[model samples]
Target: MKKDVILELAQRLRQAGISGEVVDPEAADGLSDLDEAYAVEGATRSLALGAGERLIGYKIGLTSQPARDAFDAKEPAVGHLLAGRQLEEGRPVPVAGLFQPKVEVEIAFILGEALPGPHVTAEDVRRATVAIAPAFEIVGSRWRGGARSLPMLVADNTNAAWISVGARTEALPRDMGSTAATLSVGERTIAGSGTAVMGDPAEAVAWLAGHLLRSGSRLEAGDVVMSGTLCPPTDIKAGDHLVAEVGGLGRIVLDVV
Candidate 1:
């Protein structure tokens, strides 16, 4: 994909995001491959960073088999995470600022050391992780409904909107795969385990690091990576108070208002 084409698609995405108007990604050319989609994402990141948003970390999408099947793909996707959208524990997740809002449970890893990909393993992620916390990744798409593919999702930054992180724990469990997560919205609750995310949350981080390294990037210190979701995402609306609990970790509350 040409640089100009990438920039053009990114600008369209930015406008669609701000105006809450979903656009079709197929309308853009050269988005057929993952690399091209990533290029578009890089261009979008550049636009966001140029507009004063700081890159805090990255988001890994579709690490679980179910998630991948839903997207009609076998591999995972990655997205950039900006600083201002990082909400603290117990903070209100303002719905007024989002486009088609949804939420999912994830374990966020804050890195203490740089981990470059390709050779990065799950143990490497665990060793480099300085803190682990329960998180809610608020997802929103800038694209309208249609035959959306992984590339389209990738180009849209893996539908990243906001990240709500709870209190961080310095010690990670010996078996992160066994950690259970429950997401409650009012009376309905959805449950899953860390194993849903590639058998372990750390494994997802390792996958993202390796993917980034293959693309010539690395996960740096101070970067917070939102490992893949534990369960399917729940659609959200205004006046919805949501809580996510992770066993052995802690809980994070998000009020959609």
Candidate 2:
């Protein structure tokens, strides 16, 4: 992709983000290739930084079977997470700042040490992780269409907006794959487990580390990595209070305003 086109897409995304308007980025040419899509993502990150958003971490998406099924993808997609988009525990997120927001329950890792990987394992992620938290990933799309393809989603930061994190815990579970999760909004509920995310949440981090290695990058200390969602994302509305409880990891609450 040309640098000009990349910058153009970044401006489009930035405008869409602020106005809560959806755009069809595919309408722009040369975003079909995987590498080109990632280039566009990088340009968007640069644009966000220029607007004063801090780079905090990364997120893995489509690792859940349901998400993969929804996007017709065989593997996970990765995207940038900005510090400005991170929410404090129990805070209300203004719905007006987002476009078609939805929420998903997840387990997030705060790395204690840098991890550079081509062959990183789950145990590697476990050793590097200093703390864990129950999290809610607030997802939205700049894309105008209802459903999306991998390349299109990749170029749009995998539909990420804000990540609502609960309190951190040092007592990491022994078997994360077996960790249970329950997401509740008012009376409606959805249940899943860590295993729904690539067998183990650590494995998802490991996968991300290895994937980043392909681009000559690494996961650094203090980086917060969000593993994939435990279940399909739930559409949120104003005045909704959503709670996600991860067994042994405590709970996170997100209030949509």
Candidate 3:
């Protein structure tokens, strides 16, 4: 995609405070024709328009191998973080504004300082992390019934809608990947995964930093990063019990409605 079109779309969407039915494929020769950077920039613009703020951090979606195979993606896709969409632990995720929502378990990170991208390491992620927190993410696909194209979902903040940040755990392990944990929604076990997230949740965070740096973006201090889904995402419904607990990390709960 043309650099000008990227900024233009962002500018237009920000000014309008409304999302187009889908980016005019012709406008940028079809987003599928463009690269990932263009998609990320367009999404950044849309969010900036609709009361979106600076990207605190990013997320690496589809971390599990099974999920990776299902999506036919060799690597993880990224998404921006918005403060307005963040939710506290043990809170209900508002069903409004979400169409065909799904939920995933993840470990979130709190950065301590600015960490520019394009050349970051899992250790960099480790140094930047102040703590690990249990999290449940509400993913709303731009497509119906969870059918989302890679470019489409990437452009729509990785289908990221709302996030439930659970309690911050004790000091993080040197290698968070090996950590084992269970997830439950009000006494009922949902599913579980740990180091399964890209071999290390920090690695996923590192990938985001590098991806953004190459796109002229950077991770800032005090930013919250969604490492990625530890387990496969599950369909969600109202009145469901939603609780998540990482091995070393504690637990968090939210209501479907």
Off by over 4 Å in 3: 1-29, 34-37, 40-54, 145-147, 186-188
TM-score of each: 0.94, 0.95, 0.82
The models' CA-based lDDT, in order, is 0.86, 0.86, 0.70
The residue pairs in collision within model 1 are none
- Global CA lDDT of candidate 1, please? 0.86
Model 1, span 63-100: residue lDDT tens? 88988899888788899999877886667887654556
Q: Write the per-residue lDDT of candidate 3 for residues 192-235, one digit (tens) a residue.
A: 66667888888888888877787677888888889888766777
Kindly state the number of residue pairs that clash in model 1: 0
lDDT of 2 at 54: 90
What TM-score number comes out for model 2?
0.95
For each candidate in turn, give its C-alpha RMSD to the true structure in angstroms: 1.7, 1.5, 3.7
